[model samples]
Each structure stands twice: as structure tokens, then as C-alpha cells.
Target: MALVNQTGSVFWSSNKSTTVVNTVAQLLDNGNFVLRPENDENPEKYIWQSFDHPTDTLLPEMKLVWDLKSGINRFLRSWKTNDDPATGDYAYKLDNRGFPELVIFNNETIHWRAGPWNGKRFSGVPQMKGVGIMRFELQENSDEISYSFEMLNTSLYSRLVINSSGIMQRFVWVEGAKFWNQYWYFPGDKCDNFGECGPFGICNANPAQMCNCTIGFRPKNQQAWDLRDPSDGCVRSSKLDCGSDRFLPFKNMKLPESSKAFVDQTMNLSVCGEICKKNCSCVAYANMKITQGGSGCVMWGGDLIDMRQYDDSEDGGQDLHVRVAASDLGMFSIAYE
Candidate 1:
């Protein structure tokens, strides 16, 4: 039998090859709504489920992914309005152009970026580090890259979502209050907006001004910069010389946009730097995995984009080394060894 309600019948299945039989769909107390064989109660045998087609909420063990060949994905789209269940202006999606990064798009433009993953969590979203109750996992394979989280205690309830206003959030159910309390949310400040400081710019909300160009960079449009509009981004203060360029190390930084980076899972950090120094097109490089003492490398060949400064006192940051002009390295009083 199909599921019917006052609104009408809603059949939940992403696979067209599925056939309906004597099965029952049950919404478990753990927030999982599953459809399984009528005679088989074990969840591992579930043939179809609403959890797989999550509209806006991400329950425990649910995943957000990007696939190149199959194009199958489970992402969140904002509701059109507070009163409607229609598609809206923003979409929370995982982009795998080069490496994988979680991005929120408004119409076809990037509105917010969670930054690329650095093994443990999204490079920019230090807050995503699961607390005592929640545990997180990220997996990248030959076919796809995905992120998911599980509850350390199955009895507790937690959910993540891309809300209508283009913000990503996580909420936890408070049993006594019988409500979901906001655990955290993203795009929390002006600096959190996608590319807020523009190319080669690093944003820090705590600073008097959130925007500043990185070493060896200058405003692309000084006129627009004076008007407080940095969308024009930045330009390198000097041209890169592949033969003698030096790397400026920034600790506890959210790495630049990765869609244009060259990713290789086999190279170590030393080899990554050597290879990057040999490529005149390369601008920056960083380890892909922070765990296991680091494992992969992503070398950005295009203009570095969407970088931000994180409060190092908090937690979870990556080390990024960007190729710089020899004179610029001298500005920091460091030898270009």
C-alpha cells in the first residue's frame, strides 16, 4: 500500500527500478523514516527510505555528497517561504570541481562557502567539529566525496539544515523543553559571505575592518575598494617566478577555494611544495588531510579565492603556504631560504 495523507499520496523513492510490494514505511523515533519488507524488521534490509531523500533536514547517519559520473546527490534546498514547501532561492550543495567543498548558492552565484575539507572538517567551519554527543565522518573515493555525521549516543536527536535565509545550521532537540535548540549556524558574520574579502584577501570579523589583502597582493580596483566594494578581488603585487619563489606560511587559516586546485592524494607536503614551486601557474598549496599526520595535497594553480582568518584559539585549522615574491618575503623580515 502507498502512503496517503490529507494532502494526497506521497511515494518516496529516488530509484525508479523499485517495485512496491507488501512493505511498510515506518517513521522511527530516532527521526528515521524507513520503508522495509513487511516481514523483515531489520533496518539493514530497508529497500527505500525518506531519510535518503532528505528535503531540508539532515538526520544522523545521513550524507551530503557530490558525484561526477552518476550525478546522484542528497543536498538541501531552502524552502521558498515560511508558509510554503516550494523550492526557494538558495541551495546547500557539495561541489567537487577539483576537491570537495560545501557551498550555498543563490540562483547560480556563490552566496556562502563552508570552505574545502582538510581531513577532519570543512577548512572554514571549525564549529562543525562534533561535540561530545555527535561524531563526524568524511569519505572520498574514486567515485564521490561525501560528509556525514553520527550520534555518539543514538538516544539523542540532532539535525543540520540549510535554512531559508541562506544560512546553514545545526539544532539539537531539548527533551525537557520539547523543542530544537540551535547548536550552531554558519554565515554568522559579514566575513562569512562567500569571497567577502575577494581574491587573495583574508577576512577576519574581529578586525576593525573585515577585509585585508594578503602578502604580495593589492586591491584589484582601488577605486571600488575606496567605495568599500571588494568584489573585484585582488591582484598579485608582483609576478611569480617559478624558479626562485618562496612560500609564505599562514597557520590556522581556512584554505582558499579548491574548485580550481589540482588535487593529488599520493603526494606528501614536501613533494607538494616542490611540485608547486615548479609550476608557474600555482599560487598556493596545503595538505588535504589534517588527520593521520596529513596525507594528500591540493595545489592551487589559479588565483587563490575565498580565504578567511579563523580565531586560532578555537580549534581545527590548516597550514597554508602561498608562493610569494622574494621582496614580499623580505617585508616580513624573513629570508627566502
Candidate 2:
């Protein structure tokens, strides 16, 4: 038997006994369902609750936690279909690899990445404008790594769900209109496609452009690039002089993949660039921020991957610094100027 509590109480039983006593109370204010003890005034002391067993949607008070020691990962997985509640193929989970970023995956393949967690929000999710209608928090300690959000207004209804197609969406319920309004969607554009541009390539979705080589670099396969095939990526125009190379600031750019890159959050951009220059294997370097008080650096050892242009008019965008040979730097500067 099952019960729903708040505005109306519902009961369902498979047995013949009419005295099957399973009560569910629905709280209209919080949208909570509590399995209560008989004639209990306080709903807080319920025996069982829906908040503890969330399926795909994370309610206001629920914690999406991950416990590495216990092997309990509590991220959301898409449903099988719109009509089915069964689990689907896509899942959103925290990647504890380099700097602890959030990754959405289709089975074993990464579909999208919400870049490393800065002090405030995910570096990749520039959509989080500010703490207005909602606020998010990431709690990481010895026991758990969890993320949760709460609406500033209790009466305002909002939900985050992962659809069966591996898409994450935010929805708001309009009580006056009696409809659900879509607020946001993950994998917002082509740039969100994991490694859409192959190694050593950068995708600039603004103006709807495809992959382009970094300064001082050219397509490894010039013919392929001319044919609109960016999978070939790019190659350095000349070998890095190491001592003579300069770090060119690619202002307002989405940072490249960090899993394969060497990152030191403690070092400033200048210091980081020096370290990269000292290593022959290091191909590029960049500051962790495009804004003021920017600290920390990410160094690319191999080829760069999954870079995109910044669209500050539409999305919150960050900048990156790319290293290049002195001659290439001069050429790029002259051409742009």
C-alpha cells in the first residue's frame, strides 16, 4: 500500500485486506510527500520520505551527493523515455580526474563537460548569472562531494531534469498560467559538443564558425581544412624556440580540455607560462580567468582540444592565453592590427 499526504491522501493496495494502513500525506507548500505515523501532527517525523529517494529531478532540499568511500554516487540519470520512468543511457556525474569537474556522458563517451569548479560556479557554465532566483552550492569534504540548489522564493517552482535523450533542462512552473516554462538547456550549442574540433583545433561557434588553429599554428592537413574538414586539427608553424616563444593572450575564449593538460591552481599566469616554457613538451599555456584577479594557470603538454570562442553577449564567457613562437606571434599581431 502507498499514501500521498498534503491536499489529498491517496491509497493503493494489492491485497484483499481493507485495513491495509499505508498513509501518504502531501504538503501543498513544499510539494513533499511524507509517509506518516497514524494521527501524527508533525510531518517532519515521518517514517519514509520522497526527498530521500529522488529519481531524476532534484527538489529544493535534496542533496546530490557522491561518496567515494561508500561508492554512492547520487547524480541524475535520464529517463528511458518521456513516458517511462526507467533509467536511460545518459548520466550527469562529477569527474574527479584533474580539478573535479562535472561531466555529462552517453554511456562511456563524454557528451559535455562543465569545466572545473572555480570558487563560485562551474567555469564552463557561464549561464549562472548571479545569485538571484536560485543559488547553488558544491560541498566537498572528506566524506562527500555534493551539489545542491535552492530557490530564493518558496512559492516559485523550479526543477532540473535530465531527459531521456541525455539533455539537461531547467523548468519553472507558472501557477497563474498553469504551464511549465523552460529556463535552460545543457549542451546549448555546437560548442558544447565534447571535442567537436579535434586535437590542436578550436571551435568558434559565434558567427557560427568551425574549428580554427591557434596563433602560430596551421592546419595539419591544409587540404582538409580547405574542404571544411577540421578533424585534422593544426600543427605548429615552427618549432618552439622555448626561450624565444611568447604567450599570446586569446582574450575571451573557452579554455581547452584540462584532463590531458598540466594545471597548477596556485600559480599565477606569468609564473605558469615560465614553467611551460621551461619544459620542451609543453605546447601552450593560459590563465585560468578572463576577468580581474585572475590567478592559476593551465599548461597544455600535447595538442589542445575542445576550445571555443566566447559569446559574452549571450553567455558568460572567459578568456585563455595560448603560447606561440615569436615569429608566429608577430604575424598574427600584424594581420589582426
Candidate 3:
């Protein structure tokens, strides 16, 4: 009824008194490690398992929960050192503030984030698309808000790790190579850094000057922007005229952070536009699910932050509609019709 730590201490325990004569701990074929009586061979018949108590690594079918009312959260904290299993400063937690987003924190500061999950996938993690390895899902209902994934190909092995340095990385085990090969990592470059370009600004890793204001937007602080410091973000060139305001179709973009997002899952893309138009605070909107002709809506109520251009030929790009005045749109003005 207890799980031992590396320090030979009882780190966690069920505290259930048992008087079983013979018991055994077994690692099942489905990657579930369970504890059961020696006579019981089925995992469903087991009592405790390693999947229920996760450490730094997340395996297939394992869930990460962030409940609102109950305050029962299951998250991962990095080891104190590379070889030490003790707690560290870096942590990965499910932030359910506005919408649900997975964020890595260095102590208490936001170090990196896998942007909010649309009905399909996380906006910042498009690499999972067409991978043919995992089937990921995001569940948010009245009871609880959680993120979980299962392997599409049962033979394949993969994991997500929050390293000691506060980097979130995904790796696949290559049997022939007999090693774990990492294909993706968060904070991969300057662009992945939380709000590198501030708000209403795009971070392009390929560009010599990584940070640039979005179309119809100007630097909030021109002096700082001219000095190669764009932390002040951007400001709209023209004010929205409510009914007449048009949406600028921003393509191949990582959707902005959703802390100030107004999400309505029942609304279609057209209805989303109508509602956004009615609300003066709504600055932008996007289709949460880009697959199957697109569905659902995500509306940004305030300043949009942490948006960037993705390089994935087709899978990674999203069409974001930014509210703009008719006059500033130029040729794009006529296309709004």
C-alpha cells in the first residue's frame, strides 16, 4: 500500500491495511505497472498502479488533470538534479484560468507553454499532426478539465518529459537505434520563449529581426522598437468601428495565448464572427478545430500575445482573423464582403 522513493523513504502510500499472504508487482503489456495479489494476473483485478502516480514522464493513456472547484491537480515536477529524483524548481502544470493550457514554470514564472488545445490539438503543438503515433484529446466539462492521449500505433513507444532545465520535450524510442530520439522541444528557439514579441506582435524565427507587428498594427513604443526592444508589443493603427470592422485573415499562425479568450464550443465559425462583431472588446477570432472543414470558436477579448509563424508545410498553420478598420484594410477591405 506504499510507493518507495529513491531515498528509501515512503514517498507515497495508500495506507490501506492488507493481510494478503503473497503479493506481487507487475508491469503489464499495456505499459501499466500494477500491484496485485500473486494469484491475480489481470490488471483490472489489481489494486494499485504506477500510471495513477506519475512523476516527470507522461506515458500513453496517462492523464494530466486540472480541476477547477476541487483543486485536485496532477502535474510533473522536474528532478532536483539530472540523477536526483528529488523535486526541482521547474514544474509542468495545467493552467485552467481562461481556457485550459499546459504551461511549464521556472519556480513561479511562466517559462514555456503549449498553447490552448482547440477541440483537435494544442495550438502551439501542431507537430503532433500527421505523426501517426498518438491520438490526443482535451476534455473540459462540468466535472473536470483534463488532457490525455493514447497511442494510435500500439507498437510505437513515446513519452513527454519536463527536463530539469525547464524544457518540455517529446521523444520516441527507436528500437533499432536502441535510444530515445527527440523530435520536438518547447522554447526551441527565441520564438518559443513566452511572449518574446509581447502582444499583437509575431515572432518569426527565420527573420533577422524576429519580432514584427501584425498588419494594421504599429509598435506601442516606437522608441523601444527602434532600439531593437519590442517588449512593449503593438497598438492598432485604426480604431474598430464595431459593425464595419473587418477581419484580417492571418494564415499559418500559432493562435495567441487564451488567458483572455472567450470560448463558445457550441457556436460555428460564422456565429463566432457575429458575436465578435457585436462585442467591442473582441479583437480577434479563430476556428478551434481546423480539421474537417473547421468547427468551434475561440475569441480573444484583449491583447493577443505569444503568436508566431509555424514552418510545417500544411499541418501546423491556422487561419486567424484579426479585427481591422475598413480604411486600413486597403485591398483587403473589399474582400471582407
Most lDDT-accurate candidate: 3
Best by TM-score: 1
Error of 3 at 81 (Å): 2.3
Model 3 regions more than 4 Å off? 2-23, 37-46, 312-314
lDDT of 2: 0.72
lDDT of 1 at 54: 68
Ranking by lDDT: 3, 1, 2
The residue-by-residue lDDT of candidate 2 on 1-337, one tens digit each, is 4445675666543222334275545453555555665676475756656665567787776777778789787787888898998888888877765456778889889999877655566766777765478887777777878887889998797888888888888898899999989888889987788887788787777654477887788888888888877777888898887777776666545666777767676799778867877887787676554446777787777777777766667454465656678888775554321
Global lDDT of each model? 0.81, 0.72, 0.82
Between prediction 1 and prediction 2, the one with superior TM-score is: 1
Q: Each candidate's TM vs. the true structure?
A: 0.91, 0.79, 0.89
User: Compared to the true structure, candidate 1 yields what TM-score?
Assistant: 0.91
lDDT of 3 by residue, 58-162 (tens): 888888887667888888888888899899889888888776788888999988888877667777777777677788988888878888788888888889888
165-214 in candidate 1: lDDT tens per residue?
A: 88888999899999999999988888788888787888887877678887
Error of 1 at 193 (Å): 0.6
Query: In order, how many clashes per candidate?
Result: 0, 8, 0
Q: Show model 2 residue runs off by greater than 4 Å.
A: 1-54, 260-265, 285-292, 331-337
